[model samples]
Target: MDPLDSSISLGAASEAAAAKEDVESPDALLPWARFSAWLECVCVVTFDLELGQAIELVYPLDAKLTEKEKTSICYLAFPDSYSGCLGDTQFSFRLRHSVGRGNRGTWYEDGDLYNRDAPVPLQKEQSHLYGYVYFRQVKDGSVKRGYFQKSLVLVSRLPFPQLFRALLQVVAPEYFEKQEPCLEAVCNEIDQWPAPAPGQVLTLPVMGVVIQVRIPSSDDKPGDSPVTPSPKENLLPAPIILPSPHEQDLFQCFQSMLIHVQMLWELMLLGEPIVVMAPSPTMCSETVLALVSSISPLKYCCDFRPYFTIHDSEFKEYTTRTQAPPNVILGVTNPFFIKTFQFWPHIIRLGDVKMAGDLPKQVKVKKLAKLKSLDTKPGIYTAYKTFLHKDKMLIKRLLKGIQKKRPCEVQSALLRRHLLELTQSFIIPLERYLASLMPLQRSISPWKTPPQIRPFSQEEFISTLEHAGPQLTSVLKGDWLGLYRRFFRSHNFDGWYRLRLREMTHKVESLHLEVTCDADLLAWTIEKSEVEIVDLILKLREKLLRARKQQLGVGEQLLERLERSIHTVINSLPNDLQALLHRH
Candidate 1:
């Protein structure tokens, strides 16, 4: 389109869409021709251009257009109805070919279009667009004589300027949705703005396309440059402001963003065909539409626009534009342009931009996240309580030791604490609470509520004869113990008094064995309890008594010593042995 084509300009919003002359391609279009065949399958079609959008084209078979006018008309690429628009939209279009309803075979009008499966003759309205061709006249050179208005009714729905952002989001999904975000905070000294330093370049990823940019050299250099001592060597290369991967892509994304904005600017009441000035060539109209269409703003209120563009010139030198101010972005002079177009495209190297490493003394920075954790059970946090006060010792002695010995101990990943109350396995506790709810006299404890776990009833508890949690588990295997404990918690304990008594006897026998020889050795070697002295003293007293009372006749003095010793032992306890024996 010419820079200022009146037709390309947007007409009054109230004015109806322009009537496009119906023209067909230049060629013999038989009833069963290729063009007609393609048309047969064209459920929808549209012509799009950067200039504007068009819809509802009425083509008359006899209608014709001049060559210049035909060439200027935008290309309608697809077919679809105009459901709606974002806001004030501009469209320049012409309908060239169309076929309406009312065909002879398998033809259904309006609601019945879905049932058509066979070819049929088309009605006048059904055959709205004429299948015609364009060719230069052999003699008169009259542009209008080439093809009559073909019976084609083409309708296109151009996006409203307001939807420009949405359109880009739809069309070029990768660029808009996936562009890298830019970096911030070069210094606390000044609000972040583009630095105008030489040799400053940063890598950027736009929609995945990567580029290195240099801050445009500032004829507007900052007042602050690193001070050199002793008139030292060369000034340090001016800091090149670089973008994180996200920032690079963000910059590229900004280009599309501009196009989107320009389109909306029109709808926003800044009516004008969006002009994108960059060193690169203009994009095809279809491409522009594609970029816009990728985003579906019809749903989300915010999205990307495809038609937006920033500066048209490649950053060949320090350029200034009110649209983009150095105060807004640190202009980096591109170095790749100096080498060749193919090698160093879209790259700028700034040498004087402020160094991000340099920080201001005034502002405070907060720490980011403390880091990672891995726990499968939601709320069961790792509880390793130690009496040790030193963290270093705890880590070295406990954590490291456990890791070394238990290679399969829940890997480092599975160690997180849940901040919320645990609902899981609470059933285990709940069942216990519910079973205890029975009336005081008739409370029956279930012994096997959970199949894998058994709760220990009073009977089972008596069998252990010690602590239910620790001692009972010692008698049974892990699985049986789990079942016993679960059942004991859930089932009612009734009609098992005799079994309970027997279990108690077994517990007593077990305790008897524990105390005999084993308890003494265990207490001496492990627990170091002094209870072993009681049995030792009893045996010594028996040996001394037998020796003193032999048939040879024991001495009275020795007998007295023996009796005194026995009295001493008996006096140690509240009850005397003589009284205990007498009571029995």
Candidate 2:
């Protein structure tokens, strides 16, 4: 199986005819008879490009090939009443020889010669030789003696230079159209843009590409240059000043974005995330459609995961099948996305800055603000309370709605799952909050007591027991406890709960009798009523005792201290232990 023989189509009846034509038409770009036979099988082919999008092409039998067969020319024609840009277009493309014995060679369209590797400049309502051609040999030689995979790239000639220039201006206005700009030049221009300081967002609207740019550090230079501090190092980056496109180009500027897909490809490769913002779903869709079809040399492109944050009506159609890869994204901007993701990408201004319009105004920076959870046990508790506080109204409403509903098993199950989801969502914050509190617990001074409290350890112990008791009981009784266990191992919960309870209990029993401060004792007594404190302790001890009975791995020392705390709190309560327990 010689690899060369497989693709060369040796010893075929049509080879002699093709070889003859090659001799006769040394410069007559005509398709080989053998290649023509292969083109007949090409129904249609489509490809999804990185920034631009999918290219749709149809190969007609009248296509022509160069004498070497490595390059070919074709009338890039779509069917009558065909879907995309309508016109008879000419494409000149290059073909790749096959690789392995079984491997088919691949080729993509070439960028516009006049446009200089920019988008293929197609003319509107007129026929023109624009776009590229591609073909591959197929192995199934049984039925159709020759079969080749074929594709075409055709775009409307809508004067894309205007939009390309606009994109350049939005990205770096001062250097707009100064000359053919490269990445390094653009970065330098960006370094001097009258844009907000780093971390602040700057919006740029070209045509299809809407950018929400975030300035990282004013001093952070993009290209390789020896670091030079600004004369006023203390000053922030200049405020964003959006450039107005020339009025003549402004009208067609939106459509011109279809021509500059190269800019996006370059931006993505820049190693920083590119945030593409759009004005509306309609605009986003139209822009993306124009982009995918207009990109030059549309073959041999990389895969892109396009994520659409469109309206509910369009979500099913535009949304990706899976989560977006960290690299790619295309959608509208909103606070939800801004707050949800920890990192922000550098912006790509599409048409003009004003295109973002009121969309940016809708972003409530203060309302969407979030602070990382504090580190400390109390901090954890505080965070837990914060999470609950934020959602308390919703939880109450859900519970109330559940109460009003007829007790159907399915409905009840759904309500239960809803509660579980709500609870699970905030558990991370709680865990983080608790983890932060550990150091504070360790840092408490053993020799000194706070002015208005019992021993620090004892107060913390009582607080832990009170908080842990209800949670443990809820877990034991809730039908959805399995959901909690699935994410948090049972041993983890038990160990965390046990440690806090044990520490608190140890401090309480080891209290010094050095005339305990009356004011501090009185304040402590008011903060935690004897009866309520006793009840909570008893409940925790009961849960621990049950765990011990079931061999759920309760530590012996932890259990003993819990029991002692229960007895001591019970003795201090208003009524005797039996009466207090029964009433509670």
Candidate 3:
């Protein structure tokens, strides 16, 4: 045989042995024979600027079993960072039998797993003790892509007998959600060509671009929020979580942010003008990426900086390792490449701040000062009152974006007042607003709710319950119920319920301690008798009124009940409140 053919055969044999663990001898390990194939090795993960890149392992993260069990339950798995963008990626596994372990049989009509035009149908049967079994790779290693790495892990999975379920659940699907976009971006490119006619050669999809940022000097500050390495993060800055099944409301903030971005983008498209004020290195970049991605496939002039300018390329080489950032920034070499940034028709950089090209005029430049005039944007003030996220710094920065366009002074004031109220809501991190509020979220969001009314601000009370929001969540959670219960059993105040219950107490006390022998109770007996049946009935009416005051929240039904209680209490009183024996 030719030396090269001999070498190829020998190399193939050795590779197969390594896979089967043949060094131990199959005869010594009966009932199991292994086969090995290197197959093709393509990147399990890839990236594009439109979607980023990666390889994903969509496994049964909740599965759990012993290592030995896993061996019998066989499966095929790849390491990944998938967020499970592929909704239907799971496949079935089976055991095939043969007359002889070494026998190779015809496996498929089209051939093995390499059939690109057909589904990879699987076959396995009960042992006849005379055949060779072959396993096929149904789905090959895929080039996954996404904004984050978790997508690979989310969509891909380990083999059957799923023992890795628990491992998968340790993380969340959100960790790999973006993998769909990234993977799709890469996969679509592999089998796709740009739009074209029957004979005209089509253009290829644009390859991904890289972007790097240079903050110049953005060392961590003393008290800045640290970005955890995990792909998913809890909203609470302190790491506290709500009771099971409860999630803090983020609708207000997120919705508001989305609306603002949508409007800003639309305005820019309409040539309405833009205002760039203090652009944060962190927020500005994140905003740009998300904003661009959301409105993808749209043409725009993107002016991004070169690699060397974003960071000190020489310093990065010296360190050999640069810190990873929270905001996304893919790099080519010297500067980080903004993958999405490539979609823009042009890019404006700090380097161009002094340039004389038609760039500034060609691209709509809205200044930050102009946006502040939008004081009346209803959406702006709405979020200040409702957002439940603890990332106040992010909010403040985002708020700055639309502050330039706000209008409506009184409305804005009311909105701020409402914000103060919600900021101090019982469920939120009230600690931040403690100095700013009292028992009640005394103030409102600056642009919504009522203005801060001095004198009565601290005394913002609707009886013993809420006279505020329609939800009245605060009163339901506070001590109002307990206080109302205490009110039902008045200490010395004459009330109907108290007088009625007094009979029960008297009977019990009497039954336990004979009335004649209870000498100290003589004065109490005289006072209790003073209620008299008719007056006790009238006191009952007053007691009923106070009962209504408890456990009230901010609603029309509650308000009506409170009014009736006040009326009943006033009618029961023999004189004005001034004449009452329990007057404070």
Estimated TM-score for each candidate:
0.15, 0.19, 0.16
Better of 2 and 3 by TM-score: 2
Q: Highest TM-score: give the candidate number.
A: 2
TM-score of 3: 0.16
Per-residue lDDT of candidate 1, residues 438-551 (tens digit): 233212221111112133344544344233233221221223334334333321122122233333433333233222212222233233222433453454355444433321
As for lDDT, the candidate ahead, 1 or 3, is 3
For candidate 3, write residues 129-155 as lDDT tens digits.
110011111233453322222212211
Ranked by TM-score, top first: 2, 3, 1
* C-alpha lDDT (0 to 100) for residue 301 of candidate 3: 26
lDDT of predicted model 2: 0.30
**In candidate 2, how many Å is residue 99 off?**
24
Better of 1 and 2 by TM-score: 2
- Superior by lDDT: candidate 1 or candidate 2: 2
Question: Which 10 residues in a row give candidate 3 its minimum summed lDDT?
Answer: 33-42
Give the least accurate 10-residue stretch of model 2, judged by summed lDDT.
376-385
lDDT (tens digit, per residue) of candidate 2 on 104-181: 111122221222222211211112212222222234354343332223322112222222233433432221223122
